[model samples]
Target: MESQLQQLVRHTRVHEIVGDVIRVHATGVALGDLAEVQNTDDEISLARVIALDRNLASLQVFAGGKGLSTDATVRFLGRPLDVVYSPNILGRIFRGSGEPMDGGPDLSTEPRVKVGGPTVNPVMRVMPTKMIETGIPMIDLFNCLVESQKIPIFSIAGEPHSELLARIGFQANADVLVFGGLGLIFDDYYFFRTAFEEHGVFARTVMFVNQASDPLVERLLVPDMALAVAEKFAVEENKRVLVLLTDMTAYADAMKEIGVAQERIPAVRGYMGDLYTQLAQRYEKACDFKGAGSVTILTVTTMPGDDVTHPVPDNTGYITEGQFYLHGGIIDPFGSLSRLKQHVIGKATREDHSQIMNAMVRLYSEAVEAQRKQAMAFELSPFDQKLLRFGTLFRERFMDIRISMPVTEALDLCWKTLAECFEPQELLMKQALVEKYFPKDVGPVAVNEAPIHG
Candidate 1:
């Protein structure tokens, strides 16, 4: 039956072939239609129509255009790229092309859905009011991750951002997690699979990986594929889906490479002019459907040479709610901010949460100032000494990425740290909160029970 269907589709001879892209002069080809390219060697490849004119259609071949000629036959499938979506996809790993890579049964018989559609409408969105805890003090306590929020982790190259993302995937409070790894090395890909399986979250995870050795065009498809399935889970199944993409810089680089291949003019930092629009199209997919579940996006966008002004992170900062600045192996509390936290911090958490959060950050800032003063050989006051001690304890107890705890426990530790550092009158937080939540007698902070890998 499939062979008969293929025989019915008309085939057009390739008129022009660019690097990994072929132009076919056809009458009825539509944009985003899938196509099959048969090279002179009789080797077959898959492609998708990226641009369409009156009779000229440009298709991006999934397999690179290495060996081909005008003699090649291009058959348009008359449809966009799609994937088989079902509950069985929950625990599977797939290539960027959406083919199963886990040696599992084929999902061809399942219902299919098209990818790269428009984002949800504003009227259909519910304002995010719920917190998504990740069991990390830096995120859950300081910059709370809200449901349906789009945010990024800004870091430099050679960081543990991937490890951090895997930890969140394992510990995050969500019904489903879809991870898209773009341009990753084989080692990195292996690490994620091992981590997910060992942590037992693989049962709820769906991974789409585009390795460095893979064709560059597939890197462009990973995020869209992950989000398309995630949207199905969130809207149809009413499941809270969390999507994580690592090293979006690589994805942006892939886009730039493809844009250059297409002969488009470059914008800032030698990237495509439509960089912002392209990024927003993916980030805007994070939506909390009214009376349904939500989709939250937490991506890692590494800055080249640690330059935030680079086109990728610069445009991303504008679209996202806020960013997590990961520096020196920690989520910098001073650098990170969550705009939607206000919707959940005081309301969903304890009464002292907002006050305690403010007080800790304020004192940490003062402690940093005191350290600078001491470095300049300035005379130190008694309060400065207290701040110095407080800063040291804060970093050791809270700022370390390995410190994992629930929000309530983090709040308790905050009070304990403050009580040990300053007298009640010295701390300027609300008197009621201080008397209510503050520890009466300073003692040792509780020993961490969660594994460090989490």
Candidate 2:
């Protein structure tokens, strides 16, 4: 005869079966009163038992769902969800359930572990000082990416956030790249896979992808799997891992769906009340583990209608250190920033880096105002006239996303452009830097340099 605990779990119907409400009796607690849910399509990792009665047990499912049946069996496992972890997870992919989707091998045979664990205490945290060079001029020269840093690419659905993530994965100085895709289109998945393969970094990269076609619950697991694998690599293999997650909005939406399933009171915007805490837990995973390689998180948050005030972005903005805003094709310098850049800019990079970045953006902002004035047909002042020419050159030369140059070369180009367009005094850079960096003026020639005005 089976034990009473086993028997209790066996008879109880999975709350998710009829809806998302489990039933357990007081005696069931001794037999691990919780019921194991049988989710045929989506992965439902047990989170918590929020509300429980003598006959009813309400559980929170990590991966939210829409198609669960209340009649499904909820057998008590007497345990929480666990995910397997190890340095071996590198170059691997997983579903939101932390199950392998890479067509390689099943991790079921290996010991499984849990994701969304508690973060490290602040007392153990060390100040971050290492720089991660992506070779992207906008990122490297201005807002330098740092180890253990958390940054988000804030964009709308149509923007090229995935492209940017792939670019960083391929080029970032980190030893390993773990990519988590949630609610991604098939094309985006293919694009990331192709980009890494073409760059020959696919072997060093792990992709945990939850496509738009996958179960919404699965989409929720992508980040946890990616982070778990990254944590293993960081602690055991001593690898500097960069974890990239996309479209956190989908993850939040999944939460809302699951909350509805469990009949929990909705918080702001129908999101779970724990939204901020949930985000902080994941983002706080970025850490420079003592005596080990660091883990950095650079995820994408797509703002619906480009509204930063949207809950997803709004919460993310508070949690992440900084954001890289992508609009049109270029990373908008005005909109993007790395708060940790202060740790690297000028201090770790070239001395001219900080000044050049500041000068360039200041000029760009002035150009925007000038363009607005131009649009309004305002009479241009001498400085505004000069700004007009500078703005045109800035877009064609610097702001174009296709413009890829080494950090040093980009700084030199800035000096050269200024020399060509304006006298040294107009540049407003330090007098000493002007003398050292400013390219030599093309001196007047007798007749060759002069245009013959007839």
Q: Give the number of the best model, judged by lDDT.
A: 1
TM-score per prediction, in order, is 0.95, 0.85
Per residue, candidate 2 scores C-alpha lDDT tens digits across 274-338 of: 99887888999999888888899999899988999988899999999999989887788888889
> What is the lDDT for 82 in model 2?
61
Per-model RMSD to reference: 4.0, 5.6
For residues 9-51, write the lDDT of model 1, one tens digit per residue: 6798998888988888886666777899998888999998887
Error of 2 at 141 (Å): 2.3
Q: Show the colliding residue pairs in model 1.
A: none
Look at candidate 2 and tell me the lDDT of residue 56.
Answer: 66
- Identify the runs in model 2 with alpha carbons over 4 angstroms from their true place: 1-11, 15-55, 59-72, 105-112, 441-454
* Candidate 1 runs further than 4 Å off: 1-8, 443-454
